[model samples]
Target: MAPNLSQAIERIDAAHSEDPTKVDIDGEPTPYELIYAKKMSKFLELHTPNPDPLLATAARAQHFRRWEVPRDSYPRTKPGYFAWRTFLKKRQADQVRQLCLDCNYSEAEADKVAALVAKEDLKKGEGKGDADAQIIEDVACLVFLDDQFDEFEKGHDEEKIIGILQKTWVKMGKRGQDLALQMDLSDRAKELVGKALAG
Candidate 1:
């Protein structure tokens, strides 16, 4: 990594280290968002050959100060869920944009990283879109599936889980889908994914 990129990632990790939520990692209590940010970087590195510095930074900062906006703050309805997600995307992007600028990235570069963090112009269906943005989306989806899906599935009903899986499948590009297929998910998660793909 370039010096600037390494410094930016360190700054992002410093922010993540403050997350109040803790999870066990190898018998040590670790900050949840810190773990998530690391997973995002690892997935992007593993998937994107010679990943862009901006994309790597965006991935590292994807959930920048996420715990500040708790999900339960919004209503449990679908519209509320969408609103919360929309608000979070903007908030995180804005925060990371400023962070990038503080790290000495040019304004254009910071804006690009913010746009990638916001997932602007991702390839939703078949039409062409920004390759870097798509790669960021793929990394995020891969991280969620690999790290969060099991606990996430336990909370939601089977129908909801399958629906989320299907939507997740649609958001991913081909590379993400193939990578997801290869993940070593538990039997129940595999079953849910199979049912989702079948539909």
Candidate 2:
């Protein structure tokens, strides 16, 4: 990694260190969003060993300071969920854009990073799916499936779980879908996923 990119990632992690929520990763107590960002980068690396600098930066800062936007700030219903997600996407993208600029990235590179962070033109961009956008989607979907699915499933109903799974599946490429199927989900989660795929 370039020193500037490493510095950007480190600064992002430092901001996330303020989060109170913690999770154990391989027996180490890791801050929530910090670990999430790390997982996202790792998944992106696994998806494409030779990722562009902009794509890598976008992935590493996807959830930049996510804890600052508490989910409870919105309504508890689906509309609220959508609103929160939409707001967070913009916020994260903006934060990443500034971070990239601070890292000495050109405006073109910052714009590309922002677009990926916001997941722009995911399925329809370029009229045939943008490859970089798809890579961003695939990495995020894989990270959620591999690391966050269990906790996510615990709070949602089966119908909601299935709906989310279907949406996530659609965002993924064939490789990501294949990897998702091989994840070690609990039996209930697996059943819900199977039903979602079938439906």
Clashing pairs in 2: none
Q: Evaluate all candidate structures by whole-model CA lDDT and list the values in order.
A: 0.91, 0.84
lDDT of 1 by residue, 76-190 (tens): 9999999999999999999999988888888899999999988898864668899888889889999999999999898989999999999989988889999999999999999
- C-alpha RMSD of each candidate structure in angstroms: 1.8, 2.5
Which parts of model 1 have CA positions greater than 4 angstroms off? 1-3
Candidate 2 regions exceeding 4 Å error are 1-3, 26-28, 125-127
Q: Which predicted model would earn the best TM-score?
A: 1
Q: Count clashing pairs, candidate 1.
A: 0
lDDT of 2 by residue, 1-199 (tens): 2327777777777887877889887998878888888888888888889787888888888777778888999999999999999999999898888888888888888888898999887876226667888898898988888788888898988888999999888778887887778877778778888999999
TM-score for candidate 2, please give it.
Answer: 0.88
